[model samples]
Target: MLSRLSPRTWLLAAAVCAVLAAGTSLVYGGARVQPASWPQARPEPIALGRPPALPWPSHGQAAVAVAGQAGTLRVYGKQRPVPIASVTKVMTALVILRDHPPGGPSIRVDRQAAIESGNRDESTVAITEGQSFTERQLLELMLIPSGNNAARLLARWDAGSEEAFVGRMNTTAAKLGMKNTTYTGASGYEPTTVSTAVDQLKLARQAMKDPVLRDIVATARTTIPGVKGEIVNSNKLLALPGVVGLKTGTSTPAGGALLWAAHPTSGDRDRLILGVVLRQGEPGDALEDRKKAAFVASRRLIVAAQRSGWAKTR
Candidate 1:
C-alpha cells in the first residue's frame, strides 16, 4: 500500500511522519523545546558636538570629557605633560584598589609613614606607628586629606616599595591610553611625576568607576577612629552643584591640578562629566592659592559645559 501511494501523497505522509517523530522524541525527553530568544539590539549612543565657545581657562591646560566616551570636547593651553602634584594619588588609589580592593587586609603604619606625618611641608594624616587601618580607611586618609604619607604607605603595602608601585601606575596609565602620563613617585610630591590635563581626565574616568574610590572622593568629610579630627576633602569643587568626587594636586612646579568628576542632568539623562585642569596659577604661588585657582577654573569649565550643552542625551 505504501509503495502504491501517489508521489504527492507520499511526500505529505513523509512530512507528517517527520513531525510525529520529532514530537515523539520530545515526549520521550519529557520536555518541549522552545525557540531560543534573540537578543534585542542595543540603542546607539548619542553623538554630541563641541560647543563653539567654552570658558577655557586662560593660564592652564584643561580638558573636559564625558565618561565612557573617547577623546575630549575642547582642550586649552599646551598639551605637553606637566607636573600633576597630588593628583597623582588618583592613580595611586586606582592601582591600590586594583591589587587590594576596599575591604581587603589591614595595613600597619610603619615608622617612616608615621615620621612623614610630622612634615609640615606636605599634607599628612596623624596615624601613629603600628596603628592598623583597612585598605578603605587608608584610601580615605590619602585621598580626603591629600596625605602624602598615606599614599606612600598604600604604595608600599601594595607593591612592597613605592618604586615598584609607581611602575605599576605608569603601566596602568599606558593601558588606559594615557600616552602623555608618567609616574615617578607614588605621591605626586616629585615634580618629575607628570601628565597632561587630557591624560589625567582619562585617569579620573577610571578612578570613578571603582565604587569604593567613587564613594571616598564624594565624601565631604569623615573622621577616622584614631585620627585627631575630621579629614576634609581637598577638592573644594565638591561643594559645587553638580560636582562629585575627584582628586586635587598642588605644588610649586605642578601649580594646581584637578582631576574632577560631575554628574549634571541634561534633559532626563544624568551625564557623567570628567575633567582635568592642570597648571593653574603661577608656579611661585602658594599651594593653597594654586589649589584654589584649579578649583575656580574647574567650576567655570563645569558650568560652561552645561550651558553649552556639552552633556547631551540621546
Candidate 2:
C-alpha cells in the first residue's frame, strides 16, 4: 500500500493514523475530565464568633438549643437527671402517635383514670368512667391540661399496660440519644420519672417535628367533651411572643419542669428554638409558685436567646 501511494498521499494517511491513535489513547485513559468550575472546591461558611451568652437560670438546670440543628447552645445549673413530672407526657404522646395515629379509635375512661382525676394532689382533667375520647382528644387532655390520668390511659391503650408503655418510652428515649433520661411512668406522677435538661432539650427537638404534637402543645386552651370548664395548657410560656408548643411538668419531687419551642418574630418561619428548664425552685415550695418560677426563668432565657440572635444564627 505504501509503495502504491504518492509521497504526498502517503503523508496524509500517516497523519490520519496518528490522529486516530491520539483519540483512542484519550478514550482509554483512566483520568476523568470535568468542567473547570465543577472540580473547584467551595469554601465552607465559617462561624464568625462564639455563640452569644444566654441568660441561664441561676438555680436548677436548664438548656437551650435549636431545632433541625445539632447540640445544645447553652446550659446552666446541674446536668444530672432529676424528676421531670408531667413532661414525661411528651414521650407518652410520641409513643401513642407512633402506635396509634391522631384519628384512631377512641379510648374509654377507666376506673384508674377517674380515680386519678379525682385526686386533689395531682394535675388531671376530670373525666367520667365509661366515657370515651379519640386519640387526638386524649392527647389534648394529656398534654394541654397536663392530665395525669389521660397519659396513663393512652399508655395502657397503646401497650396493654402502663408498665409496658413505660418500657417503650425508655426505648424511645434511648433511640433519641437521651442517655440521662429514665421513665418509670407515662404520667410522670411518680418521683422516679427523671431526665436532664439536655436530654429533654433533645426530646423537644424531635417532638416538635410531629405536626400533631406541635398543634396540641401550642394550643393554650380548648374544650373537650365531658370536661366542664375549659382545659388550659400548663405551659404558660405560650403567651410569650413567637412562643409555640412544648410541655410543662410540676410535682413535689420534680419541682417545676418545662420544655418549650418557639420561632423568632422577624426571622425564617421554619426556624425553631427549643429550651428546657427543670427544677426551678425548691421542691417543697408550693406547686404553683414553683411552676411560676420555672415560667419566669424560661421567659428570661427565651427573651435573652432572641436578643442574642439565636433564631438567625447557625
Candidate 3:
C-alpha cells in the first residue's frame, strides 16, 4: 500500500517523515549544543590611552602628591567626600601637637577614654583610666597604633570633650588649606566624618614637617603602659625600607586607605602618596597591596628625580 501511493501522497509522506525525524533528533539530542574546539570566545579589548602626565591614581577614590628634590606630581580624585577611617587620627594628632607641643605636662587617661576601649571594634592602646602617659606617647598611640582610646584621651585632655576636639580638628584642617575635609569625631568611626585624598595629602605633608610627628610615625615599636602590658605601633610600613612617616585607615564604609611618605637616605628629597579604596572586598590584603604599590610608585618618583638631577643617588 505504501508503494502504490500517488506522487502527491508520496510527497506528503516524505514531509511527515522529515518532521518526525527532526522531532526525534531534538528529543534525543538534549538541550545543550556542543561546539567544535570548545569555541574560544574573545573578550572585548580595552583601548589604551596616553598615560597621564602623572601615574594614574590607584583605582577608586585616590589622590597622590609626590614631591622630591626631583619634581612634584599631584592628582585629584572625583571630588566626593568619603569617610577616611583612622586616617582621621592623623589630624587628631596634628591638632594635639599644635595645642600641646611634645614636652608639656603628661596627660592622664580618664574614664571617658577608658570607656571606649574594646567597644565599636576600634583599634586601641589599652589605656586604663588613671594611667599616665606623655603627650608624646599618646601621639604615638594615636598615629602609630591608631588607638581609639588614645584619641578620646587626647580629645578629653585637649578640649574636655571629643566633640569640641573635633571642632579643633576641622579648624586646624581649614587652617592648613584642607577645604574638603571635615571631622565628626576624633576616632573616625563615624561614617559622616569624611575627607578627600587631596585634603589628606595636605595634612600629611604638614604632619611630615613636624619633627615630633615625623619621629612618632617612624617608630616601629613604642612602649605604652597598658592595663596589662605594653602596646606597640601596628603600622607595618614602619619596618619597610625608605618609608619615613605615614598613616593607614580602614572601616566598613571606607575600605582600606593610606597616606604615605618616603625619602631615600641618600637624597634630601621625599615623595608623598595618598591611596584610598572604598568598599574593597578584602580590606586587609587590599591595604597592604596599596601600600606596596605606593612605595614602588614613590620610589619611581625618587629615581626620576635622581635621573633629572633633582636628587642625588648615593
Q: Write the per-residue lDDT of candidate 1 for residues 171-222, one digit (tens) a residue.
A: 9999999999899998899999989987887788788888898999999998
> Where is model 2 more than 4 Å wrong at Cα?
1-50
Clash count of each predicted structure: 0, 0, 0
Model 1 segments more than 4 A misplaced: 1-52, 70-72
* Cα lDDT of model 3 by residue, 1-314, tens digit: 77798999889778756755454332334674322332226765643221134444355455544442223434545767788788788888888888888788878878877777767676776767788888988787788778888887889889988889988999898998989888999988788889887777778778887889888878877575553555555556556556666777777667666666665444344433333333223455555564454445444443333334322322
List runs of model 3 lying over 4 Å from the truth.
Answer: 1-58, 67-71, 226-230, 265-314
| TM-score of each model, paired residue for residue | 0.82, 0.83, 0.69
Which lDDT value does model 3 have at 92? 87
TM match of model 1 to true structure: 0.82
Query: What tens digits encode model 2's per-residue C-alpha lDDT throughout 190-258?
Result: 999899998998888788888899999999999987889888878888999989978988888989888
Error of 3 at 263 (Å): 0.2
Itemize residue pairs with steric clashes in candidate 3: none
**Candidate with the greatest TM-score versus the true structure:** 2
